[model samples]
Target: MIDEQTARERVVSAADRLFYARGVQAVGMDAVRSESGVSLKRIYALFPSKEDLIVAVLRHRTDRWNAGVTDAVDGAGTPRERLLAVFDFLAGWFREDDFRGCAFINVFGELGGGSDRIAEAVREQKESFRRQVADLVRAAGGPGHLAPQLVLLAEGAQTAAAISRDPDMAGHARAAADTLIRCALDDAGEPAAAA
Candidate 1:
């Protein structure tokens, strides 16, 4: 028998898959119950409401997504490569058969204006992505101000890749990022710090 925590995870995982594939409003609680194989009573007991379940799923996805990106960055040879590695990470993600752009972007577009909880979760995810970019920028000795632009590029690439159905979007974004980083280094007049 699955424990409560395991059962909860199953619910969240099923919800995450459904919500990402279909808009939040398009999916129903019964669908989640069916997909998760958790009893309907237990599902409601854990989430209380559909909105609560949505929030839980968003939080769970964000945690897992960030961990994946963080691991990719951590594995890089240098802080700068780590910066580029973000795009590499995205490239891998974009190439996935199930890739439908970013979950944060999709969820936000689906429910941002109507749901305060969802909006807050979306904001947190975007902020965390920027924070990761900012850390890379600082480590690479780039201008402190480039984090926002980097985030924009990263986001734009994801949107474009999803819409255009082109996995090369990541490659294109990586080139742009490299150019931006190089320019920053040239502007800083510091001999491109090793790696």
Candidate 2:
């Protein structure tokens, strides 16, 4: 028999795959139980309700994603490199066989604007991402307005990769982002491109 912690982890793991692959609304608790190989009673004991489990899953995924992006950006040599690194990360992620689309976006689609908690969580995650990018741009000495444009380009690249399965979108996104960063630098009366 799986321990309580193990059962909870299994439930979360199973739900993560299913929820991301399919949509949150499309996957039921029964499916999670079966996929996790845990009994329904144990699942209930760990998570009081499906919505509770959903929240947990979203939080877990958000944390993992944020960590990944932080790592990717931090490893780069310059702010412009860090900014473009985001697309590189997405390009690689979209190539995975299990990759579908953005989990947060899929969850939002599932909820259809109904759950305030889910909506808030999604908003917070996006806002964090935006802030992270903006801060990186500011630190790199980019103009104030470049952050928003870079964010849009990053998001657009993700959407394109998700729909078209083309890693080249990352290159295009990088080009656009680089152009914005250069413009920002130029506006700030500094070298327009990072070394």
Candidate 3:
């Protein structure tokens, strides 16, 4: 028998795949139980309700994604490169076989403007992403507001790529990001540095 930790991890893994592929609302607890190979009782024992499971799943994915972004930026040699890392990461993600829109955005849409705990979670996650991007932009010597704009562009590209099934949409986004960075630096009386 799997240990509690192992069982919980299995359930989370299953939730990640199912929740991302299909909206959280579309996937039932029974599906999570079957996919994780855990009994329904065990699944409920781990997560008291579907909402709790959704929150757990969101937290898991958010942690993983933030870690990836941190690694990507930290590995860069320069601040400009670090800023560009966000785009590079998204570009690669867009090419993935399982690529879908941002999970938070998808969940928000699935909920349809309902004000609930899940919506609040989604909002917090998105704001966190924007803040991270803003910090990177500021570090790159771009204007203070550049991060929000870049994040908007990135989110728009993700939505477009998912809907149009066009992976290359990331290229346009990257170019736009480059221009935005250049403009921001110039506006700040700083010259853009080579990445």
Candidate 4:
């Protein structure tokens, strides 16, 4: 007698593990049913199709994941700290035993080109991440152009951290971010209003 919300959560949780462990294409609906213990009929009733379930899983991950990491970023004492906190958040995430890089990046690589919905979801997450950094960058007094560059650093850190299996890449990225911020603040060009 599981409620609809409970059943939905169970399905999404099962799908996340299965899909992350073995690409979305490899895990079948039946496996989700078995893992979640939600009858096939109920599963379908909750999510009409495998694609629907995949979309739902991505959405679920985005919501929960964003809330946690964004809180870390937002709770920083300063704008620059907020920017660096993003890498800190990533570092924490990379330490998890189940860490396998970002879910959006992983799923997009596996099914992005052919799946419009998947690509859209990944794009939305990426854009949301960039916007967060952009806000931090503006608040930190960095040049407007630095937002995208910072995003590249953040994403590169993720890939490097995953490949090297070393969370210390977060430190490297944070150092680079610090340097960028310093340079931006120290730039004493000829734009002096009172020559």
Best by lDDT: 1
**Which whole-number lDDT from 0 to 100 does residue 120 have in model 4?**
96
Residue-level lDDT tens digits of model 2 in 31-97: 9988999989989889998888888888888888889888888888876788777777776777788
> Per-residue lDDT tens digits of candidate 1, residues 96-180?
9999998888988888899999899989988888998998888777898777777888899999999999999999999998888
| Model 1: residues with Cα > 4 Å off, grouped in runs | 193-195
- By lDDT, the better pick of 3 and 4 is 3
TM-score top scorer: 1
How far does residue 162 in candidate 2 sit from its true spot (Å)?
1.7
So what's the TM-score on candidate 2?
A: 0.91
lDDT of each: 0.88, 0.81, 0.84, 0.83
The 10-residue segment of model 1 with minimum total lDDT is: 186-195
lDDT comparing candidate 2 with the true structure:
0.81
The runs of at least 3 residues in candidate 4 whose Cα sits more than 4 Å from the true structure, single-residue gaps closed, are 188-195
Q: Please give, for residues 2-50, the per-residue lDDT of candidate 4 as tens digits.
A: 9999999999999999998888989999999999999999999989888
Kindly list the per-residue Cα lDDT of model 3 for residues 1-195, writing each as its tens digit.
Answer: 899999998999999899899878789988998899999899999999887778787888888888878888888887777877887788888999999888888887887376487888887788889889988877777878888888888889999999998988888988998888877777877754463
